[model samples]
Target: MRPARTTVATAVAAVAALTAVTGCADKTDAASGGKGGPAVHVTAKDDSCAVSTASFAAGHVQLAVENQGSRVTEVELLFPDGRIATERENLGPGTRATVTAEVKAGTYNIACIPGMKGQGIRKKVTVTGGTAERRDPAKDAAVDAYRAYAQAQADATLPKVKTFTDAVRAGDIPAARKAFAPSRVGWERTEPVAESFGDIDPKTDTRADGLEDGQKWTGWHALEKQLWQDKKLSADSKALADQLDKDLADWQQRVGRAEITPTSMANGAKELLDEVATNKITGEEDRYSHTDLSDFQANVDGAQKAYELLKPVARKNDPALSAELDKQFAAIDTLLAKYHDSHSSDGFVAYTKVAPAQRKQLSDGVNALAEPLSKLAAAVVK
Candidate 1:
């Protein structure tokens, strides 16, 4: 099973609106009026979630998050509707990080998830004053372009998934296997956007072991296992196929409604590279089919699309970073092409055929790209 790319950011944002409990203490401090934007300090302990300030002037804000708890924690800035304004996860005890986001005047939540699980400790926050956004045309263009790309990926995925599911329903193992990797290309490319919708990624993409207790195994990987690992299709397999189709359709319909911003696009691009480094490069994502390279390429494709759209602003703000990103991206692309297979189901050699040394090279390339990619959010916001 894949090392559960279970994005808690995706899950909490999805559930917060419907089930979020009301009324926690608001920790307020004097809003920062100096350079580098307002600073909101967040402390996450096993038993309590605390913030230095809960109310502040709206605009660009830096959430300085610290985990004082034994367990690793996640902290999020959420809109009233449960959309993520920004979030940081895997904060081990005594560690700290800063999350930057653009927020408008509205009500919001600062949620701290100890152990990076559940709805988290919630505190209501109020944003006073009007938009403090920089009126940059390049920033607006970047957001618009990335949103359109994300929507297009979602639209393309539904039909491909439908074809894969159709083969599953027919119990045609060979045909289903052929369709599997191609079907996932779009989803892998725009995963962070799809994941933003709550529970959708879990429903459609979770591996067997990735499931929570009592959660049914469904969607692409569930069927992949049935086809390649189990080598038999039961009535349950057909039923799973139908459910997968429905979930993907829901994703397509809702992707257009996702809240996108320049910083989110930049952050999301880095998230895709992280997906490759931790999961795809390990060949854990497509364990049964051994088609990990397809997913790897798709993740790169998505990350590159976001980076390209944000490039004008990013290049202007940090040309050196932009040049390095270009070099690393091209290096990875060249490395992947060595595994290309024109006649294969996913247009790449099976992951099982990728030698250990080759996999290490791939891993190194992703890490190389990811370092500079992480700076994208801050660069574009400038």
Candidate 2:
């Protein structure tokens, strides 16, 4: 997802203002903090993802990945097909995170993501015997849903980024500007799963404000500065464009190769809204360009997709909740349908165009969905 330099054409900033009023930004601080299961400690370094053992029995397991490296890192447990049995990501230096999972008797690998970016370090492992473990249908279905969701987003968004970058490289300012928001829809829609790649998300779409000191800003927003703000094209733009092209290609190849689960999908869906609740709504994300609406809509779309995938599980677990979620999503749909964006190819209005009252209406709608969506992972996993 790339940003262009410019003002908010679609007045979606109102959505952000309401989000701030509603205190949604704090959602990013939420953590799973796994409890109970035997904690498997995995230490991540620049060169290696150090783990105590390579064997896990078929059952519930809690894995903690510690970022011992100077740069941020993440650890993932992958089965043979690159499916994530469990993962803990974005652990800053010296910070530790955990992944609680139930694994069957199968071989697994450890993917050590370094620098909070890049194709991480990989290692092998063996999962030994346990009780005759059976896969829960709902959980199994959710895994499939997440896998399809990840792959679909990658496939849809990858080519779009290339086209956008090509316009940037060729100095087609107007074309790239128009391509910016729509192209990001794919990435935004896949936020929860796509972000698991450690470095790629930051590289593709990290905002300048989110960057720590000394962090080299490169990616979509890097090009966004030149494209919309300066309204001029140069080597700087082309270079960032080229780098973005490479990073996107890498991401396209890497995503969807990992296993998906219901819990993560539900969790990811909620997190997507949290992003909207905090950044998109508050305009912290679309700082340079005011196209927050496109991203905002895409996030809701992605979250909706996750919910759709898990609908069966939800219905089986709690019909009332499932019905309520449907109505909640429908309400947002009706609300957003009325939004008219000026810059976006779609007709949604400028982020700033929507009134605070209307923005609050949408915010409340999302928060409502979040309540039921939040319970999805646990309800289905159970």
Candidate 1: where is the Cα deviation over 4 Å? 1-35, 70-72, 92-95
Total clashes in model 1, counting residue pairs 3 or more apart in sequence or in different chains: 0
Q: What is the lDDT of residue 50 in candidate 2?
A: 83
Give per-residue CA lDDT, model 1, range 189-251, as digits (tens): 998787776568888888765677788888888888888898998779889989988998988
Local accuracy of candidate 2 as per-residue lDDT tens digits, 71-129: 54557777676655656544545665444566667788888877534447887878777
TM-score of each candidate structure, all chains considered together: 0.86, 0.70
**Candidate 2 residue spans exceeding 4 A from truth:** 1-132, 341-343
**Position 228, candidate 2: lDDT:** 73
Scored by lDDT, the top model is 1
Superposed by TM-score, candidate 2 places the C-alpha of residue 156 at a distance from the truth, in angstroms, of 1.7
